[model samples]
Target chain A: MTTAADSTVQSAPVRPFAQALKDAQTRITTHMDARLGGDDALHAAMRYAVTGGKMLRGFLVLESARLHGVAEAATLEAALAIECIHAYSLVHDDLPCMDDDDLRRGQPTVHRKWDESMAVLAGDSLQTFAFELLADPRIGPHGLTLIRGLAQASGKDGMVSGQMLDIAAETATRPLDLEQITHLQNRKTGCLISWSATAGAVMAGADEAPLRRYADALGLAFQIADDILDVEGDAAKVGKAVRKDADAGKATFVSLLGLDAAKKRAKTLMEQACDALTPYGDAAETLKDTARFVISRDS
Target chain B: MTTAADSTVQSAPVRPFAQALKDAQTRITTHMDARLGGDDALHAAMRYAVTGGKMLRGFLVLESARLHGVAEAATLEAALAIECIHAYSLVHDDLPCMDDDDLRRGQPTVHRKWDESMAVLAGDSLQTFAFELLADPRIGPHGLTLIRGLAQASGKDGMVSGQMLDIAAETATRPLDLEQITHLQNRKTGCLISWSATAGAVMAGADEAPLRRYADALGLAFQIADDILDVEGDAAKVGKAVRKDADAGKATFVSLLGLDAAKKRAKTLMEQACDALTPYGDAAETLKDTARFVISRDS
Candidate 1:
């Protein structure tokens, strides 16, 4: 029952949230810069492609890691790995052969800044780097688990599968029903979001069943909220392409269920997501608020 | 001291090599089928792209694992992972945005067979799957090390770096010297090939330093042989798009130093590659033979 505005004021404004978020961004960029330092063009492409994104995935990872008491340096590797995978997906998704967008995060896409081939290699390098980061000895065997979890979320059965479905939906003669649209979005966008959160919890050493349920609910809720915002949000606020879904005639929550119904579904999902976090006491309170922010934010 | 025809005769005779190779092909396809169910087009891309190629990388893995006394089951996952990475690389390399090649191993490229988007996703899926395979619990903590070694070989500092240099080489006004060209080819092609052998050895619990040295020498020797073959080999023998290197005016051993000097350099490299196996006694003879076969073979 805790509303977003109330929690924003009542909780000492989550002092660490903004700084932690900044730290995560810095960590991600530092690793990215070091990894892609060979050529000036390559470095510029990697930089232009990665900067200015809303760190939603990073937030999920850091919040979840914090909830699980995973303060050790070992956990930083896992957190960075999650962000790298997310960034790689975005880079590829923006290619001319895929989404074909000229801008990402309010700047020229990698292909726009550099050539398409360089962009392709940049994304490829980034994706490979994610696994390499996790394989670092500092994280020990936990890095292995993180790598496996990420591969599952990002590979064929998860994100890639979702993308194929999205591509199919674009050309399908029959309009996708609510169930089908939800299924596609859940896999396409939600899988990694969920994985980011659950990876943190798992790093914290949370039990398997609770982690599964928590990730599943949080992932779905996050996507629904994102879909809702895509229809009503500002491009300046989101710092990326907005309403492009509608422009592309892509199946979305607003299209299938109408804005009112979509809003209702998002609220319901948010409650389910919060309920999944209830047993963790005050340690998980910020995660619950974060879920609300995911829905209610202008972006 | 060994020669190509002698090594060919020693390599399980033509009959057994055919049969065992066929069996290995069956095993690989069956494993892929089980992993990627029949429903997805991504699976189709994976199946069509991975199967039927010459299992040279697989041969490296199996021979090295056997040399290190690894059980078949223990090495299967690592071997599969190596092949997946190799397949993924070929798929991307053949993309219209990259090499723009139309044929691979005498079959239509994945992008030509399917659409470009599906080919990209298939390659991406296969790449991630390689890491997942290495991270399999069945492989244990050594799985982590194996994944790291493979990822490092395929990543920015390794294979991808080689690719960037390759792209730049096409436009460079100054012809690269022998060392630069050798470094490029070794990193571009040899890194992954070396990884194929090193991964098998790692999974088999070989000593790290020795395995690393062996993989390095074998990789360089393999590239040297490839450069020699590119100058003089026929397409019917190589089963690949031959002589494209010369057509592109790319920097290579043959281009930099002419055919005879290139051949002699290859011999020196082959000897170095073979000498790397001294630590493992007669057990590593097949792998050593493989190194010699790599440089000495016409194909």
Candidate 2:
């Protein structure tokens, strides 16, 4: 936060969303590698768990920063930090005592690849590392705001609450109604997505209402698409098991609304999300495509 | 953080270190209770995990802040946040995949009291809660510094690295040498302790050399005392298992230096810790007493 890196150019053309995502992936991978150090097993496991994410959250951060004319140098570590939080959540959620998944992102989960202890420690360390990255002086004074927001978004009031509700629902005699499921998804998946989508506005101290609206609708659509994929996605393309929601007898968008209705709902949400971006006009073309990709992509 | 609670100052003059610790315990417990919300199991588990313990780390933060003339109201939450981090560490450390202890602070561990999933989520939530507290605007501009320092002290480079080393030592063919054990102990216990003990100087933006030196020596002494407690302290009094370190054949101050030398080392370190506070003279009497308490306590 000592001095702003002196660049405010947003001159890069709107690349293909696919290519933008790839660029984000590359930048974040390199950023993360430079951030992590030590030769211990925990360090190795941390690197392992942080690898191979879709980088959608990271992309959202970068794209949002670009839209606001913020320098990428100032935002790249912020982008990397969010990915660390996301990756850590995945690591812990896949532990034996939690989701117990053996595979994630087409690779063995952290616990499976290293051990349960490694997963726990790696996830714990990664969580702290995210905060450390935010503390980097390069992120500017707004870094504290981001750190606080991230904590609130990911803690009991947000993602953890969603996970907790999911666990409670798994054992409850009654199935969750739509309202309840919505509340869960809003916290579990929507919280981080919303944070990422609005990060640029927070950094710029600009109005976030439009972006918030965009993210709210877009996050729901994203979850709905995840539900759709759960029902129809191929394992080879999805990179993990499919039909998990249905198999668990859990309530999801598709289970509450019929598959056809769920698909329709997602499309409507995508439209709503795009409409929220009218404030940005053509500059948001890639974001609009991102909303489409959320539903269309296999993984 | 919104408002300072009305003060009910302790009327008693500086009494025994026991009385001081009890005061810290009562304040932190009440403070934490107010901070937590919701009736869900996750919230309950979080409260449960943080309920007991000596509040030693919390006291260090509050005392350090007080030493710098920081108002009790301003530093209370910072103290609470450090305790939250300490509590989260204990909860995670007791997981089946980690230390796997069923008992902590003389009660069933979080996992034992609830379940493994609850423990995992509670610990995760608590970690986030710590960051949230640091972000509160009430913490002043230095909130960013606190957040950053806490991250460094607790992340892979600090506590996690120490834990990893300890675990690695457990499986190593040879016992860790004194230098190796010193490195592990410094990270696992010393880092956060040092942070807490120097928090006041940081908040005051004052020279930290003296407190830093005091903490460096005190932290090592604290660990040596813990090593002694593990060997000779009563399980009932200690509120956890005793002699487990010896049973595991873990290289500790006692194991490496023998009982007499370990005790002598702790005393010498305690004296060195007190000596570092010479600049503050009688004002640091409580801290000097704390150093003594660390070495002499049964737990």
Candidate 3:
């Protein structure tokens, strides 16, 4: 499901910003390669778990830093940590005991590629690596702030709690209301994305309140669009199972609000996302385009 | 099985050092209860995971801190974080997809009491909390040092990587040599124990190399003793499914070297552990006792 944001990068002159993002990821890839150093099987699992992904969170961190007019080297290290944590979460989320999805980013999930235990350890190690990278003295004290934000967003109060709520919601007999579904989605998916943005702002030294507002809107908008895609997306283009929400009997925005209302809600949230960035004016144009790309694109 | 050390405390008035250790654990338990807040299921899992263990790692942290003359307030926080990581590892290790143990510390495993998914998330959250607690400013710069030591010891170079090796070793047809088995045991069991001691020393501003060496020797001796117990332990007393190692044909120290040789090795390692602490003199008696306990105790 390539978006206008993705295609624009494909067709246009590769902006230095995009190239910088690539270079940053390349550096992370190298660092991660060394971190997971061992025999072929372990290294393969580690690389496979991280190398393929939406990289949306990475995009968010990079764009957020750009918005703040800071290109500090430490910001790149922080962005890499955010991406590593995001990747680790996805790997664990797809385990057989969890979401049980066999495919991610058009490839077999980590557990399917290796085994469940290896996948678990790989995910666990990658997660630890995120904090290690953030705490590296070479990256300076800036890493501590990054680590704190990630810990809050990924730990009990953030993604893990959201996952518990989502799984419980799946098992419940009663139909969840829109707010209930939204709340679950906001925590499960929105929190990490929100952290990605806010972490970048912290790395670039942006104002606290405005960054929080921007992150909150962007996260919710991203999740609403994701729910919309699960309903309307093409399996061939999406490269994974679609409509699993209906199949799993889980409550989703489309299920709770109807497709038309879901679409309307998604657009409204995307508008809110864009509005949240208004404080940065032209500095946030790319992020605004990303919000539209999120809501309007079809797989 | 109850140990001589535990029985000694039961019989006599609690020594001031032992009282301090209890006080440290109590403080940590109280803080955990407060932070547990409203998540009853998670809180229950956290409490269950943390409460019944021998407290060997926590003891090391407190005792090592006492040896270094660290302030009581700071040592307690360090103990909390170290214990949290240790507990989290145990909960995850006992999951059905991992060791598949039904009982731990004479009680139902977290996965047995809760569901597998909840168990996984609970462990994940606990691991995050450990780092978050260490990153708190109250511990100052030393907190980061403690966290770094912990992350390395518990991550790729430590427990997780060791678990991977243990899992692989279970199915291997070739006999594992002493070196390979020792490597696996060192990483698997030794790493975290060493981290606990070193981290305690770091908390007390003993970031020198000699203290780290002391911790390492203690860690190795601890695992050799654990292997010895697994071979000869009474299931009723140990409160665990005994003989899993022999049943699985795993190559442990007892299996590879025989019980007599394994016991001799433990004794030798204990002597080395004691020798390593000579520089700290009488202040390190508790650590020396810990090394002796590692080899001599049942459970």
The iRMS of the candidates, in order, is: 1.0, 0.7, 1.3
Ranking by lDDT: 2, 1, 3
Candidate 2 CAPRI category: medium
How much is the lDDT of residue A128 in candidate 1? 87
Q: Ten consecutive residues with minimal summed lDDT in candidate 1 chain B? A: B8-17
**Higher-lDDT candidate of 2 and 3:** 2
TM-score winner, 1 or 3 = 1
The residue ranges of model 3 lying beyond 4 angstroms of the native Cα positions read A1-31, A34-40, A69-72, B1-24
DockQ value for model 1: 0.74
Per-residue alpha-carbon lDDT of model 2 for B1-299, expressed as tens digits? Answer: 10012101111123556687889889988888887778878888888888878888889887888889876765888888998899999999999999999889899999998999888889999999999988887787777888889999999999988898888999999999999989999999999999999888888777889999999999999999899889888999898989999998889999999998998888789889888999997778778778877887776
Native contact fraction of candidate 2?
Answer: 0.87
Backbone clashes in model 2, listed as residue pairs: A1-A137
Give the clash total for candidate 3: 0
Candidate 3's residue-wise lDDT over B1-299, tens digit each? 22223422113223444554566567667766765555557657777788867677777777777777777666766777778888888888898778999999898988898888878888888888777777776666676677777888888778888988888887888868899988988888888878777765687676556667876777777777777668788777788888888887878888888888877777777677778888887777666666666676666
Q: What ordering of candidates by TM-score runs from best to worst?
A: 2, 1, 3
True contacts kept of each: 0.75, 0.87, 0.50
Per-candidate alpha-carbon RMSD to the true structure: 3.3, 6.9, 4.1
Model 1 Cα lDDT, one tens digit per residue, B1-299: 34333543113224334455566667766666766565778878987888877676777777777767776765677777778888888888888888998888778899899888888889888899888888888775477777778778988788877888888888899878988987887778888887777766677566656666877777776786787777777776776788998888787878877777776766676667667778888777666666656665655
Q: Please report how far candidate 2 places residue B99 from its true position, in Å.
A: 0.8
- Residue-wise C-alpha lDDT for candidate 3, range A177-261, written one tens digit per residue: 8888778777788888887777666765667566667667767766766776787778776767899987877777778787787
DockQ of structure 3:
0.62
Q: Over the stretch A39-140, how does candidate 1's per-residue lDDT look in tens digits? A: 556556656656777666766777777767775455666666776677778888888889998877677788887777887888887788789878888765
Per-model lDDT: 0.74, 0.85, 0.73
